[model samples]
Target chain A: MAVPATRHDHPPSRRAAESARRAAGRSLRLGFLLACAIFFGLPVTWLLLAATKTQTSIFSDHPLSVGSFGNIAQGWSNLLTFNDGELVGWIWNSLYYAGSSVVIAVFLSVPAGYALAKYDFAGRKALLVLTLIGMIIPTAALVLPLYLQMNALGLLGTPASVILPLAFYPFAVYLCYVYCTTSLPDSLLEAARVDGASEATLFFRIVLPLSKPVIGMIFFFSFVHAWTNFFLPFVMLSDDRTFNLQVGLMMLLQSTDAINAEGGFSALPIHQPEAALAALVAVAPVLVAFVFAQRYLTASDVSGAEKG
Target chain B: MTDTETAGRRPARADRQGRRPASGAESTVEPPSKRRRRLAPYFFVAPYALFLVGFGIAPALYGLYTSLFTDSLGAGTEFAPLGNWGEVLTDYRLVDSARNVATYVALWLPSMLMLIFAIALVLHARPGRFAAAMRFVYYIPGAITGSAAALLWLFMVSPQVSPFSPLLDLLGVENATEAVSANTPLILALMGIAIHAGGWILIVYAALAALPRDVLEAAVIDGASSWQVAMRVKLPMVSRYAALILIATFAAGTQVFVEPTVLATGVPGQISSTWSINQLAYYYATQQGDFGKAAALSLALLLVGLVVALLVIYRTKFYRIDRGLS
Candidate 1:
C-alpha cells in the first residue's frame, strides 16, 4: 500500500518540478526579450517624444516626456518651411526615385523570373549564375563605376542617375525566381501551354495573377533599398535642388552651424526637434508600407531564396 | 464562341498527340516557327550583360590599370608605374583607415550577431501577434537610407538636445561634442548602426523558423531544454545562414561612409578627412582631382569585395545546386 501511494506521489512531484522549470525558463526568456526591446526601442521612442517638444524644452525638460501638442504642429511647420521648402522637395525626390525604380524592377524581374522557371533553354544555368554573382557584389563597390558611366552619358545630377542603377535590382530577380520555382510548378505551365495559350498569354493570364504576394515583397524590398540609398546619390548629384532625402539630411547636418548663426526664427531653421521630426518624416512612408505588407514578408521567403 | 471552340480543339489535339510520339503532330501543334525562340534567353539577358561588362568588368579593369600609375588630379595624365600602390600601401592615412575598418568589423560584427541571434531566439520561442509588428518596426530604420538613419541617431545621441538626455546623463555624457568625441564616437556610431540594421536579423530568424521541426522535437524529447536545443542543435544547423550574414555584414560595414561623414562634422579634427577608403577615394576624385589614386583606392576596395564575395560563394555553396544542366 505504501509502494502504490509513493508511485502515485512520484508522478505529481515530477509534474510539479517540470512545470516549475518551464515557468522559470519562460520568465527568463521574457525578461531577456524585454530588456532587448527597451535597449533598441529607447532611441526611437526618444525621437517620437522629441518631435513633439519645442526646441528649448527639448534641451531642458525630461527627455522622455511628451511635450505640448502644439509643438508637433510647430515642428511640422518648421520642417516644411525650412530653407524655402527644400525639405518637402527632398521628400518628393525620394518618392520619385524609389517609386519609379520599384515599378521598373518588378516589371523586369517578374517576367525574367517566370521565363527562367518555365522555359527550358540553353545558357539558363549561366544566366542564373550571373544573377547570383550580381546579388553578392556590394553596391558600394559599384558606385564609382556607375558614377563614371552616368557622367559619360551626361546623366549626372539628374534623377536618372539614381533611378537607372536602382532599376537593376538583381536580388529581387533572384527572389522572384526562387518564389516562382517553388510555389509554382512546371505542370501548371505545361497545362497552360496545352490549352493553346501562347508564352506571353500564359505568363500574363496564369503566372502573374498567382505571383501577387511575391511581387509585393520584391517591390517593398527594392523600394526600401532605393529610398535608403545614400552613397550613389551623394556621388552622382552635385546640386542640392536634385538631392534626395538622404542627401538632403546630410546637407542639413553640414549646414546646421550656418543656420544657427542666422539667429532669426526663419533662419534658425532645423534645430534639434525639427531634425528629429525630419528623420521621422523620412522613415514614415517605409514604416507604413511595412505594416501593411508585414504578413507576406516572412522567414520562409528568406529561406526559400537561399534553398531555391 | 469561336475563341472557346478553337482553344477546346487545341487541347484535344494535344492530348491525343501527347499519348503517342508524333514528331509531325508536335511540329503542327507547337510550331518550332523561328530560331528567335531558341535565342530569346540570351536576348532577354543582353541588357544586364551589357551592364555587367560596361559598368562592372570594364571599370574594375580600368581601376587596376590606373592603380599601377601615378597622375596628378589637374595635370595631364602621366604614368609612374606601380608607384601609387607602393605609396598607398605605406601611407599613414591608408593604414589608419584599414585599422578603423578592422576595429569596426570586430566591434560591429559580434554585437550585430549576438543581438540578432538573441532577438531571433526570443521571437521564435514565443511568437505572438506583436512579433511580426516588432520585426516590421525594427526593419523600418533599415529602409531609411544610411544617411537618414545616421542623421536620426545624431539627434538621438546629441547630449544638449537629445530626447535621451537623461539616459546620456546616466552614462555621464555632458554635451553633443563630448558624446561624439573621437574616442567614443566609433563605438556609439556602431551601436546606432547595429540597432538601425536590425531588420536583416529577420532573415536569420526566418532561416531559424524554416529548420525542420522534427529535429527540434527530437532534441526536446531527449531531455534537451530550449536553450540547449537552440545552442547545440539549431545554431550549428543554421551555421550557413550565420556565415552568410557575417560575410555580408562585414562587407557592408567596411564600406562605412555616411556615418563617419555626418559624425565628422561634430568632431572635425578628431576624425580626419580620409577616414575611410570610400571617403579617401571621394577626396581624391572630387576635392583633389587625383583620379588615378582614386581609381586605385576604388580598385583596392573592389578586390576586397570580390575576395569576401568569393569566400561566401565557396563556403556557402552559393551556386552549387544543379538546377538542370548536368
Candidate 2:
C-alpha cells in the first residue's frame, strides 16, 4: 500500500514540474518576441508621430507622443509648396515606372521560367548559369555600366533607361523558375501536351492559369524593386521633373535643415515634420501591397528548391 | 476534338514540314510533334533572351571594354590598357571602402541569419494568431526602404528624438552624428536586420510550415523534445533555404550604398561621401567624371560577388537539372 502511494505521488510531482517548465519557456518566448516587436515597431511609430510635430517639438517632445493631425496637413502643404507641388509629380512617376516595368517583368519571367523547368533543350544549362549570374550581380556593379550604355545609345535622362534595365529582372525569373520546378508537376503538363494542345495553347491555357501565384509574387517584388530603386534612376535621370520619390525625398531632406541644423538655409518650410511625412508617403504603397500579397509570399514546396 | 482530327492534324503538320508521316499511329505523329516540341522552348525563351542580352550581358561586356580605355576632357579617348584599372586598384580609398563593406557584412549577416532562423522556428513551433501578428509587425519596417529608410533611421539614431533614447544614451552617443560616426557598422547592421530580416523570417517560416507533418509526429512519438526536433530534425531539412538566404544577403551586403550615402547627406560631414565601395565607384563616375575608373571598380566588385556566387552554386548544386524532373 505504501509503495503504490509513493509511486502515484511521484508521477503527479513530475508532471507538475514539467508543466511549470513548459510555462516558463512559453513566457520567455513571448518576452523575446515582444522585445523584437518593440525594436522593429519603435522607429516607424516615431516617424508617424514625428510627421505631426513641428521641427522644434520633434526634438523636444517624447518620441512617440502625438502632436496633431493638422500638423500632418501642414507638412503635406509645405512639401507641395516646394517647387510648386513637385512631390505629386514624383509620386505619379513612381507609379508609372514601377507599373509598366512590373507588367513587362511578369510577362517575361513566367514563360521563360516555365520553359526552363518543363522542357529539356540545348543550351538550357547555359541559360540557367547566365540567369544565376544576373541574379547575384549587385545593382551597383551594373548601374554604371548600364549608364554608360544608355549614354552611348542617347537614352540618358529618359524614363526608358530606368524602366528598361529594371524590366530585365533576373530575380523574378529565378523565383518563377524555382516555383515552377517545385510546385508545378510534370504529369499535368504531359497530359495537356498529349491532348491536341499546341505549345502556345499549352502555355496560355494551362501554364498561365496555374502560374497565378508566382505571377503575383513576381509582380509584387518587381514593383517594389522599381518603385524603391534610387541608384538606377538617380544615375539615369538628371531632370528634377522625372525624379521618383526616393531621390526626390533625399533632395528634399538635403536641401532643407530637416535632419541637421548646420547648412540648409532654404526659405522653403520643409523641416523634420515634412521629411517624416514624405517618408510615410513613400512607404504607404509598399505597405498596402505587402498587406494584400502577404499570403503569396510563402514558398510552396520550398524543400524541393533545397535538395538537403 | 476527336482522335481522328488529332491524328490527321499531325500528318498535315508533317507534310507542311516537307516530311512524310511514318507508317503507323505510334510513329506517324512522332516526327512533327517532336520537332514542334523542340522549337517550343526557344519560342518561350526568346523575349527574355532579348532583354538579357540587351541589358544584362552587353552592358557588362561594354563595361569591360570601357575599363581598358582612359577618357579626358581635353584629350580624346585613348586606348590606355589597364590605366584606369591600375589607378583604382592602387587607391587607398578603395581599401578603406572595402574594409568598411567587409566589416558591415560581417556584423550584419550572422546576426541577421540567427535572428531570422530563431524567430522563424519559434513561430513555427506554435503557429497561431500571435505568430501571424508578429510577422506582420516585423514586416512593416521593410516597406520603408532606400531614401525613406535613410530618413527613418536618421531619426532613430538621434538620442534626443529617437524612441531608442535610453539605448543610445547607454551606448554613450551624444548626438546624431556621434551615433552614426562612432558606430556606423553596428548601426547599419541593426538597421539592415530590422529592414530585411522580416521578409526572410516569413520565408523560413513558410518552409517550416510546408514540412511533412508525419515526420515531426513520429519524432514526437519517439520521445523527442521540441528542442531536439527543431535542431535535429527540422534544421538540417531547411539548410537549403539558409543557403539561398546566405547567397542573396552576401551579395546585397557587399554592395552597401544607399544607407551610408543618405546618412552622409543628412549629417553633412560625419560620414564620408565614399564610405562604401559602391559609393567609391559612384564617386569615380559622378564626381570625377571618369567612367573608366568607375567601370574598372564596379567590374572588380562584380568579380568578387561572382566568386562567392560560384562557390555557393557549386556547393549547393543550385544549377543541377534533376534527371527525374527532366
Candidate 3:
C-alpha cells in the first residue's frame, strides 16, 4: 500500500500533484461525511416534519415539507386522546423504570466493577468470565427465560420485572471495570488506606469523586438500555398501563392504522402524525441525555478493556 | 445490613489465617482493619453477584431445563430432552428465518463495520468542530430505538410519503405494501445501518481519539500517507473495537425482533409474523403457548452468538486481565 518515493523526486509538478491529491481527498472525505449525515439524519428530519402535518397531508404532501404549527398541535391533541392519554402514562413509566434501574445499575455496577478490577479475590476470574458472557448474551435468549422466571415468582407485570433485569447490566459493569483498571490509580487508594481511611470511606470519597466520568457513562448507558429495551418489558408486562414507551408505541400503532392504513382499524385518529409525535416524545429524552452525556461518553473508554 | 456486613467479613480473616502457617508473621492475631480490607472486595461485589445469579445465570440454566421437557394437553409435561429442540429444529419456518437472519447479518455487518471505520477514521483524520458536529448528527438517529425505529423506518421505506420516494419510484415500488413485501431484508438492513451505524461511529471515533497521539505523529513524520497510517497503524490498534462491534452487532442481528415485529404489525399479511428467528421463538411462546420451543430456539440463537463471541475473545485476547490492581 505504500507509494514509492520516486514521485517525490520531481520538484514543482510533484508538489502541485500532491497538493491536488490532498485537496481531492479533503473534498472526498467531506462528500462522504455529508452523504452519511444525510442518510442518518433524513428519517429523523422527515419524522419531525411528519408530526407537523395533518394525517391527509402526511401522505399527500412532500415528505420533508413543514406543515402548520396548528397541525402539530392537532397531532399532539390526537396523541393525547389515544386510550385517554395512555401515551403520557407510558412516558412516565419509561422515566420511572429507566430512572430507577439506572440508579440501581450504577450503584451495583460501579462497586462490583471496582472490586473486580482492584481485588485478588478467589472467584475474580470466574466473575469476570461470567460478566463477559452475560454482557454478550442476546436479549432474545434471556427474555423468555426471564419471563418464565418472573411468572414463577409472580413478578410478571410488575415494574420490578423490567427494572430488576435492566439493572443487572453487565456492559456497564465491564465499563466500570475497565475504567477502574485503566483510569483509577492504585496508589491513590493505597494512600487513602494508609491514612486509616476505611475501605468504604476511601471508595465514597476518593473513588467516587475520581470516577464521575465513568459513573456518568454508566448512568447514561444503563438509562438508555432500560429506556430502549422492548422485548423484556413486552414479555414481562402484558398490561398496557404498565408498558414503557417502546411497548406502548407498538401497541398504540398496532391497534390504530398509523403506518399502514389497510391493516389497522380506523377507530382512533392516531395516524402518521400522531405516531410521529409519539416517536418524537419517545426519542426526545434519550436525545437530551445523549447531548448531556456527550462529554463523558468519550472520556470513559471501554476500549481500555482490551488492553493488557 | 451492618450485622451482615460484619458477618461476611469474618470468613476472610479465618480463611487467611488457615492458609498461612502457624509460624507465619500474619497467621496469628490479624488486625480488624486488615481483615476488613481483605473482605472489602466481597462486600463490594456481593450485591451485583446476587443480581447476576438471579437474573443472568438462573434464567439461562432454567431455560436449558425448560428446553428439555414437552408440554401436552392430557399427558402433562414429559421429560423428552431433545423433544422441543428437535421439533424446533425441524420446523420449516426455522430454515427460512435462519436464512433471513444470515442474509441480514451478511448485508449489515461488513458494510456497517466499514462505514463505521471509514467515518471514524476520517473524523479522526480531521478532528474539529465540523467533525464533532458530524458525529453528533450521525448519532441523533441512534436515540430513536426499537418501536420508534420501527415507526421511523416503516414510514421511510414506504414510497408514497417517504422522503426517499424518488429512489423508491426509481426502484419501481408503487406502494408501501409492495415496497415492504418485495424488500423486507434490504429495507431492514438499511434501517439497521441507519439506526445502528451512528452509535458505532461515535464509539469507534472515541477509540480513535483515545489512541496515543505520539505514535500517529511518528507515522506521519515517517511520511506514511493518511490512508497508509489509518489502514496499518490506526486500524490495527482499533481492531479490538472492531471485534467488539462485530460481536455486539452479530448478536443483535441474529436476534432481530422489533423492526420485523413492528413492521409486520403495521403492514399485516405482507411480512410474516414470524419473520426473524427470534420472532419465531416469540410466536412459539406467545401464539403457540409453548415455552419449551421458545426456550429451545432462543438458546439455539444464543449458542450461535456465544460461539462467535468466544471466537472473537480468543482471537483478540479480549479479556486478558493483566494490568489490574491485583
Candidate 4:
C-alpha cells in the first residue's frame, strides 16, 4: 500500500527521516529504471541506427547517431545484390520452416498434452518423464543425432531435415500439459464427453476452441524457436539455398567485406551494413508476431488463464 | 487424447491454493470398466509419442552411437569406442569452453535474474501506463531472434557505430572486439541476452501480482518500511517465480550459441570464438568435421542442462500433481 503523506503527529526529525527514506527509495527505483533503459534499450536502438547507416559510416559515424533514409535503402539494396537476393530467399525459407513446425507442434502437442493431463493411462508417468527429458535436453545435443539419422535416411540438406527435428517441441507439449491440467476444468471436458461427443469431436470442437490462447501462445513460441534457431539448421542443411535467417546471417557475416581478415575488402558481396539489414529482415516477422500475440500472452497467460 | 477420460476428475487434486481451489471444482465420476480407460490415453498421446521416438529418443540414441565413432563427420566412420568421449573429457578447448561457460553463467545467470527482478520489482511497485509501456518496450526485443539480437548488440558493442561509443570509449573500449575482449566476452554477450528481459520482467511482475492485496496492506499498516516490504514481504512472496526464472535461465545459458558465434565471426583465433561449449561442438560439427566429438560435447551440455532443470524441478516440486507450482 502506498503510504499516505500525512505525518501529522511525528516529531520533526522523524518526519525528515521518513521523507528522506522515501526519497531515497524513489531515487533508487528511478536509478534502476534508468539503468534498465540503458541496458535493455541501448542495443536495439543502436541496431536501428546501424540499419540506417551507410556501410562506410558504420565505421565513421557515432554509434547511435541517426542516419539517412538513403543509408537504409542502400543497406537493403546491398543486401539484395549480395549473392543476388540470397538473403531474401533465406527469409522465405525461415518462414516456411518455422510456420510448418508451429503448425505440426500445435496440432500434435495440444492433443498429446491433453492426453497426458486428462487421462489416467498406463505408462503416463513414463510419458511425462519422456516429455520432460526431451524438454530439458539441449538442442545442441539433438543436432548430431538427428544429423546422423537424417543422413542415414538420405534427407540431409532437405527442408524436412530442419522442420522435422524442430517439430518435436516437447517443451510446448509440457506447457500444454500444464495448461490443460491446471487451467481447463475437468468438468468442461466431461460435459462434452457426457453429450456423447466422440473423442475426436470433443478435441476438435471443444478443447481446441477453449485452448485458443494457449495454442496462440504455443504457436508464437514454436515459431520463435524455429525462426531463431541456428544450430539445428546449421547442422541439418549444407546447401546455402535452404538456410534459415540465422544460418544465412552467419554465412553473410563470414563473407562480409567489413570482417575479412585481410586488409582490403574481399571480393565477397556482403558487408557490415548489408548484414545488419539482413539481420533486421530476419527479426521483422517475429516482431510482428509478438505484437499480435502480446494480448494473448499477458503476464497472466499461463498462470492467469486459470483465474479467468 | 484422453480429453474424455479425466474430463472431470480433480478428486485428490482439488484443494491446492491458486486462482481456483480444486476443492469446489466438479469432478466427473469414473464410469465402470474404466479398465478400458487405460487405452484411451494412448490415443491422445500417440502424436507426441511418435515425435519423441523420431526426434528425441532416436536422435539421442544415434548421437550416443555416433559419439562412439570418430571422424564420422566425413562420409566414413572409423569406430573407436569411447575414443571421442575420452578426447572430449581431456581436451584443452573443453576446459576453456567450460570455464567460459561457467564464467558466463556466473555473470549471465545472476545478472539476468537480478536485472529482470529489479525491473519486475520496480514495475510492480508502481502499476500504471508508464510501467506497462516500459514492459512493452522491454519485451519487443523478446521477439527478436537470437542471432538478430546478437547482430544488433554487435552494433552496440562495436565502438565505431554504437551510440554508446562515447561512454564505451571513455571506458577504454576501442572496438567491438575490444568491447567483448577475448578474456571477457561475458559482458558483451549479456547485452544481447538482456534485450529479451522485458518478457521476464512481466513474468515476475505477474508473479508479484498474485500477492494478496490485503497482505501487502497489512504490512503497510504495520509500519513496515517500503524497503522491508519489498525485501522481506514481496521478495519472499515471489521467490518461487524468481527461482523458476533462475533455473530456467541458467539452463538456457548452457545453450548460449548465437551471441558468441555471431560476435566472434571473423575474429582471428579463439578470442571470443571458442568461448562457449556450443561453439566448441559447433566447431567440431562444422569446421573440424568431427561429428563424434561434436556429439560427445553436445551430450555434455545436455547432461548439464538436464541436471540443472531436474534439480530445480526437484527442489520446487514443480511436477507435483497437486499444489501446482506457481
Best by DockQ: 4
- On TM-score, who's better, 1 or 3? 3
> B20-138, model 1: which lDDT tens digit per residue?
33212434444542243455555555665555455555555556666676775586566777677766666678888888777776777677778888788777776667677567656
Ranking by lDDT: 3, 2, 4, 1
Q: What's the CA error at residue A175 for candidate 2, in Å?
A: 1.8
Single out the weakest 10-residue window by summed lDDT for candidate 1 chain A: A299-308
DockQ for the candidates, in order: 0.25, 0.35, 0.39, 0.40
lDDT per residue for candidate 4 within B1-326, as digits (tens), equals 23223323332244232334323344487444243444667788887799998999887877888888877435676888878989988888878888877877777766677778778878878877677667766766666554455556556666666677777778888776666674355554465456547756755665565454545656666566666878887887665456456555776677677667655553444354667888888788778878778889888877887778678768866555433322
Ranking by DockQ: 4, 3, 2, 1
TM-score of each: 0.77, 0.85, 0.85, 0.79
Residue by residue across B1-326, what tens digits does model 2's lDDT show?
Answer: 43233323422133223322221235445577777988999999899988988888887777778889999778889999879999999999988999999999999999999999999988888887788789878887887876556667878888877899999999888999888888989888888888889878866776566564545655665556778889987786566566667877888888887678767766668888889988998899889988788888888887787788778878977665432221
Per-residue CA lDDT of model 4 for A230-298, tens digit only, reads 878888888898898888876676555544445234465456666666666777887777656555543
lDDT tens digits by residue: candidate 3, A232-267: 788899889999999988888877877666747868
Report lDDT per candidate: 0.64, 0.78, 0.79, 0.69
Better of 1 and 4 by lDDT: 4
Alpha carbon lDDT at B231, candidate 2: 93
lDDT of 3 by residue, B150-192 (tens): 6677777778778988899999999878989988888878878
Using lDDT as the yardstick, the better of models 2 and 4 is 2
Candidate with better lDDT, 1 vs 3: 3
Candidate 2 regions with alpha-carbon error over 4 angstroms: A1-21, A151-157, A185-213, A297-308, B1-37, B73-75, B206-240, B323-326
